[model samples]
Target chain A: MDTPDTLRYTRSHEWATDPADGVVTVGITDFAQDQLGDVVFVELPKVGTKVKAGQAIAVIESVKTASDIYAPLDGEIVAVNEVLNGEPEAINAGPYEGGWLFRIEPTDPSAWNGLLEASAYEAVAQEG
Target chain B: MQRTPLYERHRDLGARLVDFAGWDMPIQYESGINQEHLAVRQDAGVFDVSHMGELRVRGAEAMAFLRYTTLNDVGRLRVGRGHYSMLPNESGGLVDDLYVYRDADDDFLVVANAGNVDTVLDALTAHAADFAVEIVDESDRWGLLALQGPAAAVRLERVAGMELTSLRKNATRDVDIGGLHVRVARTGYTGEDGFELFTAWDDTPAVWDLLIEDGALPCGLGARDTLRLEAGFPLYGHELTSTTNPLCTPFAWVVKDKPFFGRDAMWGAPCDQRLVGLKVTGRGIPRQGYTVLDADGTSVGMVTSGTLSPLTRESIAMAWIDSSLARDGTDLAVVVRAQAVPATVTTPPFYTP
Candidate 1:
């Protein structure tokens, strides 16, 4: 339930943070992973693919059901977490750290403005 | 929604509740499905299966009536024994899969699926005009609990104050637990050494508490589904449906050579498709309703039940496909999210303790 203030979130429960340079690291929120139960498979978009904001760029499948992971902002996919192919449970163990799905180089830096901050995202989580 | 007697206990234990067959039941407890599944496989786990339906038949022609109504030869069953059976419709399709127990020469008990209780009762009543038999719906009068695992007998023996050495598989006996009379049956869906306890509805909570206090982990329906899938057991709506013929599945042993309601139709049934087990050899988790394709990329079947088995850590599924292509080691593909994943036909179960 910890919504780190350093990251921005979306209504769809995805999180993005600029870990270094102009690249933003993207992953699902802890609340999202918890609701998904045990993660079994993750399908990530290929690198160099252009994605629009709010577009489904990844798929996270649990033992119970499958869910789509949306891109928070329009960007080109630069890299994806290859470790997820073998061990998707990292998302359940540490959604904020090792479970980052992909890296995106933003087309518009102002796209972050449209995303919700930690405080605002917490309200959405509560309402859900 | 209908609530079981242990609804309060489930809420207090922080179980995730969901609507199952019109009953408000726990889908998973606080520990989650994976842990609960492993608990049942390694140790002992208890399940609240009170949602299942119970029917009692008692009359001068009870044995004859049951033999003519069900797929199994009920006349072969002795007192204190039971076998898995099904109520087949006139067209060879299943009405419901059940376990019939012969309690005595003139008495019998039928345990049915929760969703098809009313349908099964109506069918049985409609067929009872010729025979002098009384079919009574006793679902609300009893509470059912299943204790499953390798250590189930040892754990239950401590709390129930009875020796379980005499009870073999599919055996039933009456025992006393904490001064309460209960019927214990050595049968379970998880393919483990286990026992199911049937007691008065009002006394279920106390017996459940006793089993938990004796080190039985309280499991939920989520784990139950996974466990049964791993065991390759056929569920009512998933594997055995109104259009599914039992003769075409791995459970054909339940059908006897004697006369029954659907015996004539089943003999003439066109069994073009047969149920087969698939082990995913490629990426993607195959699920129910997913398309099964042949090597030529032609649609041949559909998945009935599937899961990522916790024991094997491999994706496995059951599908109904062309009987000619249902052999072991047959190459196939499953369309998961529009991606064709490589799979191979294998005979279930996926795991064995």
Candidate 2:
């Protein structure tokens, strides 16, 4: 339920940190992790992999169900938080901070504006 | 979707509700499936199992009719006792696995899976032509709850005002729970010491509140599923199906040596697969429909139900494999997310009590 005003979001419940030099860190939103229940395993995409917008870049497996973490925008994966391989619960504990999944070097630096802002994302979260 | 009497309570508690067999059921609560599962394994957890179906079988031929339809020998069930049984189909398959409670010599109660109520009812009715018995669908009239765990008795005794020490396993007794006559049975799907309370439909929410007030964790179906899977109990439509032969599963003991409907189809049937437990030795969790493989990478089985055990913290699964490969210490692999993860074959009830 925590939507930080400093971030952007997607209808599929992913969040992207405000880009700096075309690089945006991505992770599932707090609402996504909460709706996903207890996290058991996190399947992250490999670093340096080029991904298109809306591509399934990662998979979050909860005890009851598994869901895809789609790419928020077309980008190149620069880094992934390996801490999730061991402590997937980090996503549940601090989704915005410690639970970040991967970093994307967006193809278009200004493409970040196309995603929903915090207020718009909060409205989508409230729809649930 | 149908709603249970505790729908409002579940929503208020922030439970994640999902559609389960046409019923709007809570899959997990705020604490999540892991916490709820551990609560039942350690302390106590209460589940709103009001969506489970109930059928009343009565008349002079009640016992005779039950024995005719199910795989278990209903004639051997003593009054006030219940046993896990299954309705068999003539095609070497199953109608459904159910609980048979003998309330009296001429009256009985059959608890069935919510999705398979009509199938079970029709199967029984088809085989009831020769017997003088009345099978009534009383699902809408009763609300059921399962209070499970090591601490369940202490918590339940405080509210129901009954001495539970003398209640043997699988036994039932009528107890007055807040002036509402409720049938409290020492039975449960989770492999824990607990009771399944059957109360009037409209009055169940009060019972739920009373139990919650007494310190039982309010659990959802998600926890119930993990608990049952950890205990190696089979879930209908997962480990079992209309085409599954009970003789091939570890629950074959439920099929007693007696004459019953679908007897020939089961005992005389050819079984190609055996249900066994799979413990993941490598990374990744096994899920349903995932292909199971032998060490040489040849396909041999398919996973039915699986999860990371909240108690053991190990990835475990139930799968049906070629009968020859279903053995203890058999090395295997489960295709998880398109990768062949290493696994080992073993028997069920993965966690020891």
Candidate 3:
């Protein structure tokens, strides 16, 4: 429900913002946070690690269950959110903005075309 | 769907509703399970557990009838005492785990889980037909609330007008609370000192308000499950199922020496898998049904119940492991998701007072 039009999303619920510096900001969508209640622990990839699109790169743990965060686009992690390691509940509070998981530098700049727009992603997420 | 008297109250509190077994229940409140769990550990918390069913057996053969139904001996229960036991089928499988309270001469009360209410009632009804006892299903007419944690005693004393030290562990007594006659038992599943209040349907709302005013926070099923799991209590469905015996779980100590159902079948039987606790050493959350392995990656067991322990700030799981690999200090691997995470076999309960 907290989808920002400026951001692009994937069917798996990761949101990425194309920040003009070639480094896209990435985090789990608000819908993902709501489904996995009360995030207690977060495991993010280290900085400078490379990952392919659709690969599971991080782990988000909640009191009820744990889920994998897939890479929305192929990129190299430039920076990781250190705050989430200690206070994972930030995802439950402000998942779209302050709860950003990591920053990525995409290998192919045009790979963003595969991502879904806000309206398109919402329809897919609402199916079930 | 089955609805308890507190269903409307939970909805009024902005609870996340879910269908649990046939009942429309609250899984969490507006404050969430983490906040409610902390409140119970530090202060006081109350849960609307009216969904759990209760059966009353009263007659000259009440004791005899109960002795033939459960695996534990009813003859050992004195007046005003309660004992935790399980009903086992003829094949040595658990029918349901329940708490039996001795109310009076030729009278007893049995409290069973919410989902197993009908199953337990049907079993008891069929068995009682051969005896001189009358079995009454009082679940629909009563409301049960569990007031747990350190401040629980203080909160209940304000309404009961009596010190709670008299109601020791596993003790039950009839008390007048706010002009309403209720049965108060000193028992809980959260590993905290608390009292379970059983009152008439109409008196539940008033009693709930009184407890809230006395500093008892309202919690839901989420906190109840996490708290009980932290206390290392075994749930009926997850730990003790129709195919799982009580002796295989960590509750073998409660299995008494008695001539009851499934006694002859399970006598001197050996269990293939034993329930033990596992603490994940790697950065992965172990979930139920995940396979556990040894250092060589050979499969040893599978996780039965797992969760993030709020009190310990660690990932812990209860699993049924091979007897040879179920010893304490044994290093194991829990296959979480797709990767295997390093885990250590530890003694249950993951946390102790």
Ranking by DockQ: 2, 1, 3
**Highest-scoring model, TM-score:** 2
User: Which digits, one per residue and each the tens of the lDDT, describe model 2 over residues B53-134?
Assistant: 9999999999878887888998999999999999889886898999999998999999999999999889888877789999
TM-score of each: 0.96, 0.97, 0.92
lDDT of 1 by residue, B122-213 (tens): 98998899899999999999899999999999999999877995698999999999999899999999988899999899999999999999
Leading candidate by DockQ:
2
User: Which stretches in model 1 have alpha-carbon errors above 4 Å?
Assistant: A18-20
Query: What is the C-alpha DockQ of each candidate?
Result: 0.66, 0.85, 0.61
After superposition on all C-alphas, the RMSD of every candidate to the true structure, in Å, is 1.6, 1.4, 2.4
TM-score of chain B of 3: 0.97
Which of the two candidates, 1 or 2, achieves a greater DockQ against the reference? 2
Find the candidate with the highest lDDT and give its number. 1
Q: Candidate 3's residue-wise lDDT over B248-279, tens digit each?
A: 76788878887777776776678888988889
